[model samples]
Target: MISIPDEIGNLSGLITVELHLNDIEGSIPTRMKELMNLQQLDLRGNRLDCSISDEFCQLKNLGWLALSNNKIHGLVPTCLGNLTSLRYLDLGSNNLTSRLPSALWSLKDILELDLSSNALIGSIPPQIQNLRAITKLNPSRNKIAGNIPDRIGSLLSLQFLDLSLNFITGMIPKSMETLIDLRYLNVSHNKLRGEIPDGGLSKNLTGQSFMMNDALCGRNPSLQIQPCVNQISQQRSNLVEMHIAYTPRLNIMIDVTSGLEYLHEGYSSPIVHCDLKPSNVLLDEDMVAHVSDFGISKLLDSGQSKTKTKTLATIGYIAPEYDQKELCLQKEMFIALGLR
Candidate 1:
């Protein structure tokens, strides 16, 4: 069909058009947008290009729009933010580039939006928080970047969020652990670091899905992490050198406990690692803790700050106040303090 005759516009009460998969060619007739009452339009399997008409936004009652498998270019229209009545939109499989419109987040009634397989770049905007009503969003296969913003965890209504194959980075937000409704998430191939949350989409990822990012570590069986001990040891050594007081006690611990005490606690007597573990703390003849191991007494992270959390490596060695799943808990340090 070349499209309904212009005379059909006079009918004035049209709500739907079913013409689809008709092997149509060339640009979508601009006059088609004149059907103000048109609620649904299907122009799939076509050779459309440039971009969808901003005129489509005129269809306030329009609920579904499919412009996929086309040659659509340029950023999506900012006017889409005005489509408060739309429930579904597909602009995938195109040459779309740049960030999505900030206005599109206003589509509170939108249920599914697929802008996948495009050239979109830049960090996924946190302005997306306005999409409080979205259930599923697929922006996979884009050039988007930075860590998935923390606001994504606030999406209580999002059940599916696919941001795979992007350049997102930094550690995965600990807040994402609270997403109880997220059943599927694909943050693979990004620069996201740290462990994946225990439940939700992360729980299902094989190490393979989250592979290729050197910063990422997960409990998934598919991922195999190299020993991180060497890295931690190097950092610990740095802090030890900075620990000025320990430098004196390094060679001689005999009856040096009191001097070390003054050094670690300072003249004010601030308690360092008040919760020492069961292992015998490394102490000199005077009960002064050594700056190095065998006693595990020196604040391993011998930085200038005496009150910093003891860097531990054991799973539960961290302080009681910290949530293990969130934050960068130095469980290894916690364990070293306990073991000897």
Candidate 2:
């Protein structure tokens, strides 16, 4: 491994330096700051094992900076925010050990920011809404704590968001439902609670998105959490009191069967709903029954027929073969019949 030579900085007219995915090691040469005309600097996927020097911040024209997947340590230089022209910044998969600098959020022109897989602390500040042009924001797998700012919905241009494997708390704001451009979201393994916002990006999500968060509840059965029982009961009571026509039993039956069919044969890999009972079936406003609670579900791989599990499904609903701790395609079919 070799370090960047100080003489390399003599190229003051240089506009780009893309020495990434190499064996480059040692601290970044401060002399590189003399490259005042530099617009992009990417040294990611290297052995650069030192703290970021503040001298690098002197490049006022820098627009794209990627230093991810390295051995870089120390606090992110707050002075880097002075580069108002920055359009992209990626510092993920490093040893950075400081709270996110508030100044970083001031990069209003930044389109993508990734600070994942570090030891960073501190809450996501409300000023994050300032990144109005941002399309991707990932800060997962960190020690970051505090509530997700409601103002996050203000980033209408956002398309992907990942906040998983963190110490965050509080409810996911309903405001997120308004982000029409959002296509992917992951907040799993956090302390999030309350009803998950419905519609929009949520409609395309699955159980994997909200996995391991025990407190969340919503009408999306694929979330695999318990339904909001009190809310459902109230809705039903109101319909009866208002003399509204309830959904026909035949319709409910059809909805349940359809849900089962999708889980069994719709995908390359079949998903087995281990528990198929009345409690796990939720009725929507239209009285449509959706299969919920996939906490004990199983997904079989290609060409795989049977699998075993130590976990048991509900007593009355468990297939006879499942009593021997084995699960096969017939297991779900048997339970579905029992539900009928």
Candidate 3:
């Protein structure tokens, strides 16, 4: 049908409506609320336009709804959360805007949720942990910011998660290490930082799953980021216990200086290693020290001598000028060596 007839609403006993992959070009009828027994509705891959009507929430028996790939705009009706029987929902590839309604997280029985490729803003709320039965969650390609809630690990049944192409910041929550059922994850193209957890699902993730996130470091070589700085400190302890002879102090000093020199002059733009400390200097089997941990490093523009940053380096090793919000590579080595 070219368009759903408003008279179809007269079928009050209808339990399901599937009009996907059609040329349907009109708005969802408000009279749809008359179908009290409707348990499922699928209208994806259509040319339908206009905002989702709040009347749909009147269908208390709605267990599944799919409206992706439409011209749907405006806020998702907050009352949809009243449908406790909703087990699946897809509103992706639309023009929906505004913050995600907090009420959506109340869907405790939701099995899959797809809200990707929209203009939605705001952070994922902590109440998200209520979706304990969720198996797949996709909110990628939106403007959502803030941390991935630490409680996300509580989704014991979660096997697929995608939060890519957003403005999300902060470390991937350590609690995610507990997601034993997770088989796929993607947090790429975001502003995430710190160490990526090294257990469970994370162990199986590849670099492709985290590409374009410059500050994320992990022990997984496939992730292609730097090794976590804490791992270097752990290695140092192991070496000391094994009675391995420490590299000469002079050699370490030279190696560190050489590394800094390269950072300052070896590239098109100068890089300032914000955190320099003994623990951040990693030693290979050959006792060769390699400078690591660029999680908070900054790259200055050509001819720029200093820049401002909110991320603080190691407290004791931070240069005095850093406190003023000015950042440069100057004197950090001395501070790292406790000479200041």
Which parts of model 3 have CA positions greater than 4 angstroms off?
232-340
Candidate 3 weakest lDDT stretch, 10 residues = 325-334
CA shift of 124, model 2, Å: 0.7
Residues 226-264, candidate 2: write the lDDT tens digits: 788787898788877564354566677678789888887
What's the lDDT for candidate 1? 0.65
Each candidate's lDDT (Cα)?
A: 0.65, 0.85, 0.87
TM-scores of the candidates are 0.62, 0.69, 0.70
**Maximum-TM-score candidate:** 3
lDDT of 3 by residue, 1-340 (tens): 4888889889999999999999799898888999999999999999998898889889999999999999999999999899999999999999999798898999999999999999999999899999989999999999999999999989999999999999999989989989998999999999999988888766788888888888888887777878878888887889785744544777877777888889888988988887777788887867677999898889889977666677758555554545666555545645665545
- Output the better candidate (1/3) by lDDT: 3
Candidate 3 whole-model C-alpha lDDT, 0 to 1: 0.87
Return the TM-score for candidate 2, rounded to 2 decimals. 0.69
